[model samples]
Target chain A: MAASASASAARPLAGDSLTIHVSSRPQLAMVSALPRSSPPTWRLGLGRPARLSTRSPHARSVRCLAAGGGLAPEMRATLDKVVASHKVVLFMKGTKDFPQCGFSHTVVQILRSLDVPFETLDVLANEALRQGLKDYSSWPTFPQLYIDGEFFGGCDITVEAYKSGELQETLEKAMCS
Target chain B: MGVTKEDVETAITSSLSPSHLVVTDTSGGCGASYEIEVVSEKFEGKRLLERHRMVNTALAPHMAEIHAVSIKKVLTPAQAQPQPEPAADKAQA
Candidate 1:
């Protein structure tokens, strides 16, 4: 957790990279058709057999997701590429060396304890990126973890995963890949 | 102004409709942090991570003011029944 020498590119939101991403991984989409009476059970479990769908009919429109925290399409594309480039990515409130938030620090400490080589993107340093990520991940908070181009979960999930030895297993697979 | 612990409890109870609930103000004096235990049938088939996510989502509106929230326990009524001791209290490290 040495902050890892700025692995993230310094591209501001001004210059949208002209990269058209054919997303190989499943992107976040709202399951609006599901009844609100129950918690969305379909979104549970990581890398389940059902997650292999490259295209689901429910994901017809680009705007199927709710109000993005104003994260632009191009910015999301850059993030998608970022998640793909690294086996592990942590978008947190601060750098790993000096994590500004408790939750971010906890997740950083967990990753460090596991001794897996991971990159950190300090959301606090970039406002647009910070807000953009909340929308990009469809998760409202910081310390969002991505293992092998997948949104693993937040601080609590990371802690639970660490305790159950799931995080290690996932990271090991990602590292080998 | 910060949110009270009851506000957090209200949000969670209304959403999860837990059979058992305990909301502790872990912030000492302030209303910024809480330690919660919720046992509900809604969590019957859900994984621990998803259970926590449900709690987090329910409290999303109040999250701006609250500094931290530790969801200590989320279990179904069946899981809660067999336990002799308070699961949430003993489970924390």
Candidate 2:
């Protein structure tokens, strides 16, 4: 019980309630506990969705997703597909390594510090994406965040969430699934 | 030939009926850059991004004349207030 508790604290967010836990040695039980809805299953992104609960690394990569920032019907649908493409996605001012704006840089730092895998779209490179994103989120700013294919908020909101530890929890959940 | 800040503000006011409105010419002498802060009932339930879109959509026709537009503050009447830095005084950054 103490070992489980320590593991929980170390992770604290990912793969908790969302996944059914099983020990490595008990291979048969882990295989049986796998959800019926889960795909036929390969060990690709998260190493067999069945073992997601026990492993932390797989959960982290699977959570990166796209931020749906396209407002038109066709573009909106495409963006929806993109959000599901990765586990975490950020529509930012610059690329992950070189942020063009201060606000975009702040978000990049937050994601980096968390050490979670994330994908970024550089709005600065494309005028249509930039303008369309403004319409899509209806927030007149760059550096927007999307979790689980939903708009979480922008730089200020991300900062506030980070301060209150909510961002960590959200990211943990994202990483878990 | 050129668009004025008042033109932009008036269009937004008519469309969104904001509680407060401020428009500034950021282009020095030319009507290129503009900054705006709008507080409106329509902004309720909408995020800052959405509010800015409404402004952007309303001004889409003048995109040719307007170059840099910074939406400094977008809030409903309840959320809008006298912050330490008002949108009127914010720098381009």
Candidate 3:
């Protein structure tokens, strides 16, 4: 990693222009790079056809969704990658250690009690993501939990599932899969 | 003006026709927060998530004014018959 970093740094001024372009057109770069990096995971979880052919129309629709409190395509695609990349992911009001909401804190405790590795994204820090997530999950509440790239539910559901041992069973299944 | 406990009750009652319903205005008087327990036939074949969705859809119009809605219990009438206690209180603790 160090050698690669140094090698990139040593490249001539021609590489600088490419870097600038990638930074300016981040959404385009992400859309183009997505197919190569993480298509299979996205396909397996959602079962939707990959957005390979209808990129422009798909992107336009995503923007429309964003306007309606849904996710922008780039944000949607990024979330697709995020959820798929982890065994568990939580989008909550605050970090795991310092939850901002009582409901968010409860979910964090339950996950900790289960003793499984999980990733959390603080929605309070990002306004766009906070709103977009409600539309994405079709659930209006926060502390949204995802297991195996599928939305499990929010705090109440998680607590109920935990009480019944269903959460443990599902986590075990996800762990193995 | 924000949403009211009565408004929430009326919405869920009209929509779900729940046999047992409790709407606690946890937001004091502001009506921004609530905890609900509902039992209805509509939830008979649904999962917990779907049951919550039904309640949410019923309250969709008022959702803009309400800041928090904690759906404490979602049950079908048959499932609710066996337990007389408020399971939500125990779960929260």
Predicted structure with the largest DockQ when compared to the true one: 3
Top-TM-score candidate index: 3
Worst 10 residues of 2 chain B by lDDT: B84-93
Worst 10 residues of 3 chain B by lDDT: B84-93
Tens digits of per-residue lDDT, candidate 2, A28-105, equal: 333333333333223222211122234334322222222222233222223443344456778887778788887789
True contacts kept of 1: 0.08
Task: List runs of model 1 lying over 4 Å from the truth.
Answer: A1-70, B90-93
Pairs that collide, model 1: none
| Local distance difference test values of all predictions, in order | 0.67, 0.59, 0.69
Quality of candidate 1 docking, DockQ: 0.26
Q: Between candidates 2 and 3, which one is better according to lDDT?
A: 3
TM-score of each: 0.71, 0.52, 0.75
- Residue B39, model 1: lDDT of 91
Worst 10 residues of 2 chain A by lDDT: A16-25
Cα-based lDDT at residue A71, candidate 1: 48
- Of 1 and 3, the candidate ranking higher by TM-score: 3
Error of 1 at A151 (Å): 1.3
The digit string of per-residue lDDT tens for model 3 on A1-177 reads: 111112223122111122211101223333355433222332112323234423323121111122123233334455555555567888898788889999999999999988998888888876656765676666777989988767788898999999999999989998987
Model 2 residue B3 lDDT score: 85
Tens digit per residue, CA lDDT, model 1, B26-63:
89869988888999999989877678778888998998
- Model 2 residue A79 CA deviation (Å) reads 3.0
